[model samples]
Target: GSSGSSGQALASDSEEADEVPEWLREGEFVTVGAHKTGVVRYVGPADFQEGTWVGVELDLPSGKNDGSIGGKQYFRCNPGYGLLVRPSRVRRATSGPSSG
Candidate 1:
């Protein structure tokens, strides 16, 4: 229900747009490496005041064997390296999931 509602909202926004960009579509994944090791997740257009690119938010690793060290973690996107990939890189990665 929540997902459906969100999807509808996104659709409505897209309809209002003059052009639909490829990065805003659902199921689009960007592998952004942690600037400092921590939990990582996706952000949607709603998360930002203005921007099309999604970002990762890192939480400090809790000392509970969750596979992280407890501390303040930071997140960022670095083009041309690792998970902080550019749109062209994402397109290349998506073109063949099983290639590498």
Candidate 2:
């Protein structure tokens, strides 16, 4: 891995990072994939990945990480219950109970 100097155009990149869905905000209820429900915890660029990412605390133990990547913590959640996904893959969960 190449460890370039820090402070390399954060503002400029942030402008593009603004692509995070306007309706997507921390604390919002969202769903990723099918049958996975979680709450939005973090919404912004991640140090380990490019573009805007959504940190979610899943209601079940079915996730990829604990809101961290490459040893960097973005948000906190139980093991296997935290995941970071692209905003495009997230959907605003319905206000009613999920159908079986």
Candidate 3:
């Protein structure tokens, strides 16, 4: 007698996504640069740039675009509210109740 089992592996389209921190995800509130806060809209590679990029919808209208660049839309947001920056420049905001 013998027993057999099969395991499945989920493959992600973008390997770059794994390179970014697991805590950084879409809809998660994050801080960009030094004094700006926004929600994570997209976390992956951009066709226009190399490495991983984080698309955020800033609360202020100081971003460069509305989540699109070079005719490609990474995410949707109000005009001038979308920005794509390296994952290194983004971090989870500590404004939540968990902050001490």
Candidate 4:
């Protein structure tokens, strides 16, 4: 998780959500960057922590330990393949088949 101390949402994200729903729910395709693709696997507060997070299964080896942070499992996946990012870090895809 790149976001530290994230028990709050960015003001910009609420502002952005007004447009087109921001469809950042489970099973949707997202990308932190342009080329990398990831799937939204889990969306909610994790165990022993606060704030909302999104568990994304990244296509590339771009993530940290597999869905477990602080020795707790929020989602399950391969190492370096699971990304627990703030919902703001991911953006819905523009023009591709999304699964949500």
Residue-level lDDT tens digits of model 2 in 1-100: 9988777665664434346677899999999988899999998888876778899999999998888889989999998999998887899999887588
lDDT of 4 by residue, 1-100 (tens): 5757757654665553322235878889888655667888888887755567888989888888798889888788899999887676778866655477
Candidate ordering by TM-score (highest first): 3, 2, 4, 1
Q: Put down candidate 1 lDDT per residue, 19-88, tens digits, no spaces.
A: 3245534344433343323222322332213333323322333212221113312233232111222222
Q: Candidate 3, residue 11: CA error in Å?
A: 21
The segments of candidate 3 whose C-alpha lies over 4 angstroms from its true place after superposition are 1-18, 97-100
Q: Give the winner by lDDT.
A: 3
> Which candidate has the highest TM-score of all?
3
Where does model 2 exceed 4 Å of error?
1-18, 97-100
Where does candidate 3 have its weakest 10-residue lDDT segment? 9-18
TM-score of 2: 0.75
Against the reference, the lDDT scores of all candidates come to: 0.30, 0.87, 0.89, 0.76
Q: Which consecutive 10 residues in model 1 have the weakest lDDT in total?
A: 80-89
lDDT of 3 by residue, 1-100 (tens): 8776665564567644436888999999999999889999998888986777999999999899999999999999999999999887898898648734
| Model 1: per-residue Cα lDDT at residue 56 | 32
TM-score of 1: 0.23
Q: Rank the candidates by lDDT, best first.
A: 3, 2, 4, 1
**Pairs clashing in candidate 4?**
none
Tell me the lDDT of model 3 at 76.
Answer: 99
